[model samples]
Target: MDFDRKQLTNEQLLDLYKKLLKPRLIEEKMLILIRQGKVSKWFSGIGQEAISVGVTAVLHKDEYILPMHRNLAVFTGRDIPLYRLFSQWQGKANGFTKGRDRSFHFGTQEFKIIGMISHLGPQLGVADGIALAHKLRNEGKVTAVFTGEGATSEGDFHEALNIAAVWELPVMFIIENNGYGLSTPTNEQYRCENIADKGIGYGIESHIIDGNNILEVYTKLDALATSMRENPRPVLLEFKTFRMRGHEEASGTKYVPQELMDMWAVKDPVTNYREYLKTEKVLTDEYDEALRAELKKEIDEHYQQASAEPAIEANLSEELNDVYKTYVFEEVNSKSNSENVRMIDAISQGLKQSMERHDKLVIMGQDIAEYGGAFKITDGFVAQFGKDRVRNTPICESAIVSAGMGLSINGYKSVIEMQFADFVSTGFNPIVNYLAKVHYRWQENADVVVRMPCGAGVQAGPFHSQTNEAWFTKTPGLKVVYPAFPYDAKGLLATAINDPNPVMFFEHKALYRSMYQDVPTDYYTLPFGKASLIKEGDDVTIISFGAGVHWALETLAKKPEINADLLDLRTLQPLDMEAIFTSVKKTGKAIILQEDTLFGGIASDIAAMIMENCFEHLDAPVKRVGSLESAIPFTKALEDQYLPKARFETALAELIAY
Candidate 1:
């Protein structure tokens, strides 16, 4: 099993010790940063560094690396700068996102850390994508993705593994079994004895390794990683590791049972590696002390430099480049007013036209090819395009997105349809990490479009009909668009297909069947980041997007007391801040609305914009109309109560009355 396993030389063993030590030191330093008010919070990679470095060292440099939040060792070994790493934790101007992005989404393409996402299990799907790309390009590289034991229980973990096994993808999935998901032990969550054993259903080679033993992790992972690269098949490994420190900055170990705490305390990966080196007579005290001091000095220097480093100033003018190439989006502010086209028909026409225009464009998803998508947006594509391009996929959200990204990386315009937007959560990682990040990391963009039916009318209940747009709005590098009228829907969707980036094109299921404004016969596309001013007025600026725009319009029609200026951000990601600023400036009032939950939604960003930049221009406090922070309910009555309604007519009156 271990073809290349060798007895480590004294120097090699010393290197393992040092690698393990770096994580512990970095984690502790991060804890100090958290306490000193330098960084907000962090998850420690303390007891799991050996597996990360050892496994990565075995894989080829061109091979992909997808690691979860707790594995900074992958970033460190892959050569992600310590300054950028520490700056990410500090949440300063120099932070990973200029303090705009989440903390654990670290690593970059420069490191060949293919894609990194904080959410659990999703990395497995992204690894599938990287492997698929390797297969297509005839490359002998493997894709290595890591996850915690808890991530193994996720639907994405199973979905990705199944597809990789089916395709025999060149992938080595390593489960970093660090004993717990926060405080809940693996035993409490998963019924399986071992995460590796769970791979039996997928019919892939799997192994369990002593993750605390650097040699074991290195030898086991190295063989599997090499085998996948050379032979090009899927393999799975479970690294039995531990967590000596608390889970994250928020976790205090207050809930950990004293018995299990004592059980794992002695097996700390860093401590184990240090002791193993001494026992094997591999390292001298002098070499060890010098290495420790050098690492400490390096850490201190990088922290100071990164903390003080100026933010990566992206020119606002250049922000357009970050979203789309100038040629893809030609500014044409006029909404289509020509005769005769229903909303659903417009969507179908748009897809057909785009696919016909670009030979690279292909549609795939459950029932998409043959049945023509859940709502028939892709009707007749399979018959015309052939199964190779318009093939139907098995019902696996993770695989759908990951595979689409793979196709996109190799110059394919992949369009995936989630049966409903609420169901898109299953593929959230691939959308955010691979589809969204490939361009930023490798400086190469993907033309991937995900058409998800969203919104909460027609009473389809919670699971089938709930708006989940903002779930994606939180993630950068991905465009989220929601169109109200048939013309904008068709135009925006067409624009998204042409753009060289991932787009969450939300087709409101509620509006899909509704006969709205007439669309033009001539195929046309609306540019990204431009909003439609439905009614320009100086009374109250009702800033909205997607389904909310229609709702705002209807409310304005019925009420005489208020004349609202409606701005529909047809493309959510490249938000038209200029339009927002102008509207708020003139109207001297802002009321943001959407069908998603109020807490942590995109409306918050709009509110923050108003408060920070346009505070002096506002005559009244900004108002937001959205569902209360809770899961969507199943019953019709509860569903009505869960969404942001135009029935908030009284609320609008109140805003204008102020």
Candidate 2:
């Protein structure tokens, strides 16, 4: 392939040289600023700028690029204004995240570059989603993602590569093998001969190249980009390079050997390209000095102008202003007013109606297409909506969420189903870090719905049953909904799909078929952050959600002497604290019930909130009843003892007596 490759003209080589020089100068300037205590820290790619320059030179403006911190040259090649970059570094209002985040942690929707998060692996999976949208739209565009050798050791890296190969998506997985993962060496990271070899097993084309040479990178990437435009296949290209500096400006290369540093310094990409330009007659002594002077002046001016911009003022009152998009509930006509419906059937109907109403809505999960999902919630969906709309995904949870994020960014609503809630830990990074922060950082709507089948009591054991909504409720920019009855499940799931934010809809596994109620088979969206007052009485106020609501209701029936105002907190994230406060004020006592463990559960949070708001009106201390602080067992007897019905009855009697 090298023998058959075309040579680059002198003019083209010169352009690549200048592109490499700009970021090198910026890194050098930033390093000085760090020494002067002007900038906080910096991640330099002094020896690997050619990788970014070569790749960005071949990409179109409309195509997307997700760049890591070391790949700052990609922004320069994309023509993003230097002042904006400086403003971001200086933490000014003119910066990308408006000074909310530091360094390469922001994105521009206009440039189609999603700013990479601090975590390394999620971006690769997210790039799969962007490529998926391009493929689905028949757009002959490719998405290029940059990461290092250490990132490939992450599970998401393998998940991203596997799915990209399986789908034959137009994605370029570029790995800059700089031989270090922060302080850890490459050998300690993986046992493989090379990172590119890992891609070969995924059935994708793999290539390794000399990353120090600017012309070599540009020529090869140019050819690869052209071929992908026509054939649309992912390419795993490894750029063998070195990190010339420490991980950041503050941390010097003490962990790196002096001999290794001396060896890589001789082959520095920027200096090597500068000499290559001079030898090729593209630069003279005077021109080289003038170019350096011009770049330095420009970098200095941008830094000064960005530093003079207004700094963002701290305002605690408007903290949650842009955390979630404001949603207003609108009336949707009921197609059928039937009351006889099971919870699973109601959820299926909601998904079907929403898909039929909005042509852009898509449902994706493992065994969802023909097998109809693990519990058959999305069964028969493929036959009705076709496999494209009702997609059967590979068993990669992280990729599934990333694909949904990519779809939402491209103006599509995605409904993703995790086979069970216990498995959400596998996909937690994208959901919490990327999808949850998109709106707050970029104001971009990631309209994705993750259907979570949670809770124990069906003998699914610790691996399958989990009520982990508490973990997500504490995270900002996410909506957590747990419905108890069929009516709320159908209405809330419909609303969640239509809502313009990332939503986690948790449906208890035990209530899927056991809980039946008269649900309206219509297009209606229930308002989030509003609790349903199941029964109103003033003796005591009981707060519950999901399967725990049934336990509370059962306890109330068992002890008819205890008059309680039972409130169902439908959405836990945007908590209905107003409803809670009102009920607590009337009753003068409160009891919080949940199916999760008592240690650091939703019950604990709600009990605190009640104590804060109604401390004066309290007749007694706020009581909380939840599952035991242990994993849910396989046997029904142990599971029953672990969960809350018996505990709730005991707590209810104590609260009434108190």
Best by TM-score: 2
Prediction 1 TM-score vs. true: 0.69
Score each candidate by Cα lDDT. Answer: 0.76, 0.87
Clashes per candidate, residues 3 or more apart or on different chains: 0, 1
How do the residues 123-218 of candidate 1 rate in per-residue lDDT, one tens digit apiece?
677677667767755788877888788777788888888888877888888888888888888879888888888778889989888777777888
Least well predicted 10-residue stretch by lDDT in candidate 2: 1-10
Q: Give the C-alpha miss distance for residue 103 in model 1, angstroms.
A: 5.0
Model 2 clash pairs are 339-518
Q: Residues 82-110, candidate 2: write the lDDT tens digits.
A: 99999888888787776678888877878
Question: What's the lDDT for candidate 2?
Answer: 0.87
Every model's TM-score: 0.69, 0.96
